[model samples]
Target: MPIRAGEWLAHGSQPEWTMTVVEKTQGAPRDAGPLAELDDHGLVAACLAGRRDAFDLLVDRHKRSVYLLCYRFVGTHEDASDLSQDVFLRAYRGLRRFRGDSSFATWLYRIGVNVCLNRVSMRQPLQRSLDEMPNLAAPQADPAVALVRREEARRVRAAVARLPRKQRTALILRVYHDLPHKEIASALGTSVGAVKANFFHALANLKKLLAADTRSGS
Candidate 1:
């Protein structure tokens, strides 16, 4: 669980069974995450000028959050890493086109949602397999309580994944990313009103499904 350098990844049948081993406890201070030495515009400029190291800084700051979002959307670690990589690659390609009208973080997440949507569309919305969720919560003293909590989180995530792609993107952007509705609208190339509409419907549908689940104990 240590965030050390040169970790080895070992995966079992389920992602929860996978683990990492760190070779070193610490690294250089320069590798520390981007603490806003450059604004979004400056970073983008450096990236466009072929300073690849600048892009690495951006990724270090946002990759953890972005990968977690992808894992929630796709329900698998194998695919989430791929999706996260794809998101960064797409952002790299599109950096030249980014008008700087929006913050670069917002631009990156906009692309992240689109990548997740494309991934979901390739599979049937209702065909989620629930045996592979990764447990990121703190471990509970009682194993039964931990199992129940993990199962409940997986069920909720599956329901969210099944939503229409736009609605899912809207809800995750606004909720997980803690993005404002107005910013989400700009990211998705829509209006604030449309973002609200998606969030409203997405929340309503998820609530209904989760309520039914509680009643049935599924």
Candidate 2:
């Protein structure tokens, strides 16, 4: 599909989520002024002009987000890596077709979510288990810190993975990807209200799941 630019809309009550930016081409209206200063559209433009190096800047910028998206959606480093490659490769090949009508990351995540959905649809029932997918991205911490952080991340991913498809997508897109509701709608191919509804259910379930995990541990 041809890309449109900057249509990443947010809900009226979006949470304050800061995103890292990346570098972009000079003299563009949105130059990547600071390292990680590049916006979605700028990266798209540079990559489309045969500047593969520009794509690296975008990769470095969103790699963690994309990797986390994969981990949350699939719960395994194996599948996430597979899907991450699919996401970026699809982007690279499809860049020329983009019309710059949406934020590049939004469009990219639309790709990510769809990729996950397709993977889920193709899985066998027994293969759909969630408890095995752990968040392997925990930062280096003291033994106690690592234990606490890893424990929390594991609990969160398990809860998120158990959510129904819509809820999981909404929760991950909003909480993990830091996208607003409307952009999430665009990515999920749904409405803003639906996105909110899904996010609510997903978060509620995650909280419940976390509470249960805590109670069990205690």
Candidate 3:
């Protein structure tokens, strides 16, 4: 996908397939043709130009990852879906502030992190459990082994949630989302050094938390 500049939407949906375009004689959509080929910035431009379909494309592209991030925060599919929509809505409303300082995905993730953090703080002690880890077994694999792995993943997630805010954010963005320290720093509004320090402590603390859990037979 190529990122190009447009007068409007200089920055930033769903899957490419879900965007249905219709040809109109007047007010024909810009970048309507081959929208999937345009990069995120280009789509943002189109969206600014009043092409709703372009925003839909952006949502399709990012919805899965955004939902996953929200799920990790709230730990429920329903809440995650609602937060994902809220994230996109906020992004759409705040598009003018994007500034193109970071990649579109990074900017969107920053918004998501803020939204999730606010939600978590409002409802201290997030009630849901993180049991949505991917299935690691073949169809014929042993159920007991899968259950054990799921339990371990759940414990690890619980430990992560217990981490200090900065450490948890650093670890989640770095480990789960595969974000670089620089990007995580940008998202966290902190320095790369701080991000690294937090991530390191997050790992060490996570190990201690899990070990304690084991010793306690939990």
1 or 2, greater by lDDT: 1
- Badly placed stretches (over 4 Å) of model 3 are 1-32, 125-140
lDDT per residue as tens, model 2, 1-218: 33222333345444355343455544333433442455667767766767666777777666677888887787777888888988888888888876676677788888888888788778722233334644345556576776676667667777777789899899888887789999999877789999999889888888898888789889
Q: Report the error of model 2 at residue 99, Å.
A: 2.5
Residue-level lDDT of model 3, residues 94-212, one tens digit each, is: 88787788888899989999998898778754444435544454632777777777777677878887888778888888998999999989887889999999999999999999999
* Estimated TM-score for each candidate: 0.79, 0.66, 0.79
Residue by residue across 95-155, what tens digits does model 1's lDDT show?
8999999888888888888888888889743334445545555768998887778777777
What TM-score does model 1 achieve against the real structure? Answer: 0.79
lDDT for model 2: 0.74
Please identify model 2 stretches exceeding 4 Å from their true place.
1-43, 124-145, 207-218
TM-score of 2: 0.66
Candidate 3 total steric clashes: 10
The lDDT leader among the candidates is: 3
RMSD of each: 8.7, 15.1, 12.1
